[model samples]
Target: MKDRVTTPLGAVTLLLLLVAVGLGLSSPLDVNQGSLVRLMFVHVPTAWVSYLAYGGTGLFGLLYLMTRKRRWDRLAMASGELGVLFTVATIVGGMLWAKPTWGTYWVWDARLTTTALSLVVYGGYLLIRAMIDDPERRARVSAVVGIVGTLYIPINYMAVEWWRGVHQTQTLKLLGKVRFDAAPVYGWVLLAATIAFTLLYLYLLRVRGILAARDEAREERELMNDLQGDVSGLTPHIAGQGAQRGGAQHG
Candidate 1:
């Protein structure tokens, strides 16, 4: 753990997080939402990371299907795990932000609903892996599910615009045309926050992938050990049966 944190990538991630926190703290209050606007610093970045992580899950899953490699499956699993985590964080942060803004901690608005649905979908992806014993079959099924689950990401992102729900439309739009509604300072702080969160996600993904690989290795070793133990126990029984048959023949 200490070795991981001391690595170059980890050091960079830590530095960026510190910078984002400083910028978010010093950022001016929103003209409307006041202090509540600060929540955007954490909320928006977490949402972005969730989207990124889920997207990676789908992409890596596809690669696994094409290549049939354990590494790809491991990466896909890691991405899915991180996706679920960030999705939960995003929901919690949003709920905190919403209480003051909308007077409620929960809502069935399109964006919120879709976001919740995506969380469930990925959660199921992890569940599927746990239920299946065969690694190859598990990888195949999980890859397909991961690919299908990613469709929710676009739907969730566009839900506010498509349904015109209580949730606000995209504050920063880059497709077709680039537009930022808030002050320039907000954008800068948000950019910093986004970068920091992305780095954090990458760091977590690498660590998780390594752990998954180790787990697979350990499980494989245990399985081999069990098979060898069964064979060794059967060998003595077979030998005794053969000796008894020989003795009966002699008598």
Candidate 2:
């Protein structure tokens, strides 16, 4: 199948650009936060996409184990790595916003702690893969980590409610509801940014999967060459044995 970026990602890129332009012009000049709140368009959507990428990794990891297909494994691996990158982006961006709004760059708040722990977990996952030379073992360990690491996502989301924390209550949520100080145009802008970042995430995953597949195919070809060489060496000895058998039969 043709990759999504070669086709659908074009639509996403175009649409997101138009929405971003609209958001910039429509945002009201807030009395308290001023124009800085416009950063919400990018920040909130990036946070959502980070969760999406990791969720995809976990789902595909399960599918890979069930079907025993290397393609699914590749998808999972690519998503997991990309998820880590995006998760880091979300934390950094949150800190940037928090410094101005909350008056501090760092916090021991539940939400922040959970996200930091998530980073450490994934970091260890990556480090373990690097330490191991064998391919099969690496996949096995990563699959386990991807599967179990899912618990942290919810913790990150509910950290404010679940504990007395520095993080604010979720603004965009089902129960508590959201109250945005921006125009309806800004809402569309947020929707556009979410879709755009998500497309970018998958695009990166597909690119990484392509490189990994090439590396795997190259290794397989090398193994085939070694096997053929061994077979070539044994062929001469086998023919000599056949000749001796023929001589015994003639006698």
Candidate 3:
């Protein structure tokens, strides 16, 4: 694992994380949230990674369906797993931040509700994969599910705007009119954190993809070995029966 962490990509990801942490620590506190604003450094970036991971899952799932390749399926599965993990992280971080801000641990806000739905959707996707035994069928069915589940992303993003719930509207907008509510330094720190988290997601995705491929390959090998063993065990019994039949016929 030292070797893995020492690779160029991993090294860069680690470096970025360190820089983000340093910037976040040094950044001025929010006037409204005070030091609690630091939580945004973690919460926003994790939320971003969750979105990225699910998007990757859908993209790779589409590729798998189109090409019928195990590699694509593996990548889709890896992305789904990471997406679920990061979604959970996002929720937990949000809850931690919300408890103090909202005086409640949970709420039925549109954004929060939609985010929860997204978690369920991808969680179900992983569960479906576990239930299926046939690799080909599993890949096909899960690919469709992965692709469809991505529909939640847009809805989740727009939930605050559409429903006008307690959840705040988008703070950082990429397209059209650029909007950032926080101070410039805060935005800079957030940008750094986002870059770090994105890199971390990519690094984790690559690791997870490799592990998934190895796991599938290992399972296939074990299945083939079991079949070969069964055949070998039956061969002597069949031969013995054949000899007995020959003897009876001679008698």
Candidate 4:
């Protein structure tokens, strides 16, 4: 069947660009944060996307363990990579916003520190998976890590409130709770950004999953060929031994 999902990936890319322009260039400047508020369009979405990616990774990892299917493992792997990408973007954008707002790029603030630690943990997950050669073993170990690593998500979200920090409390809420308080335009822009980032993540996930499956298939083919070659090499010796035994029996 023709892949419908990947076909729209390019369109999603274009849409994301439009959303970025609208959020970063057209959105009105904040009275307090001024132009620095523009960074929110990038920062907030990336942070949320990273959360989504990690969540999906954990979900797929669990699915793989239950089903023992390589496709589920591949999906988990793809999501993990996307998670790492967006996590890095979130950190970089946060640091950019911090330098101006907090007067320093690096700080021991709970939110920032927890986010950094979360990045390290996810990065370690990727590193360990790369070091292992066996696909099944790699998936098993990585799934365990993926599930455990997600514990950081809630901690990261609550860090600003749990401990004293300059980081702002969670602004977005459910059931019309306005905690972060911004202009109507900002809210609209945030909604648009969230949708755009989600589409981008799905598109990337589809592409990554395809590549991973192809790579796995190629590796399997190569392994099968190697085994066949070894069996072929042993065939002549076995045939000769059988022929000698036949002649000895006849004599």
Q: Against the true structure, what is each candidate's TM-score?
A: 0.94, 0.81, 0.93, 0.91
Arranged by TM-score with the best first, the candidates are 1, 3, 4, 2
Output the lDDT of residue 195, model 1.
96
lDDT measured at residue 3 in model 1 versus the true structure, 0 to 100: 57
Look at candidate 2 and tell me the lDDT of residue 29.
63
Model 3 agreement with the true structure over 83-187: per-residue lDDT tens digits: 989999989999998999999989999888988988899999999999999999999999999999888888887787889977777778665787996677788
Model 2 regions lying over 4 Å from their true place: 1-11, 14-18, 175-185, 229-251
Segments in model 3 whose C-alpha atoms lie over 4 Å from true places? 1-6
lDDT (C-alpha, whole model) for all candidates: 0.92, 0.76, 0.90, 0.85
RMSD in Å for all candidates: 2.1, 3.6, 2.2, 2.1
lDDT of 3 at 201: 93
- The digit string of per-residue lDDT tens for model 4 on 137-178 reads 999999988998888888887788779777887766422454
Q: Which ten-residue region of model 3 has the weakest summed lDDT?
A: 1-10
Question: Which prediction has the highest lDDT against the true structure?
Answer: 1
Deviation from native of the Cα of residue 16 in model 1, angstroms: 0.7
lDDT of 4: 0.85
| Clash pairs (backbone) in predicted model 2 | none
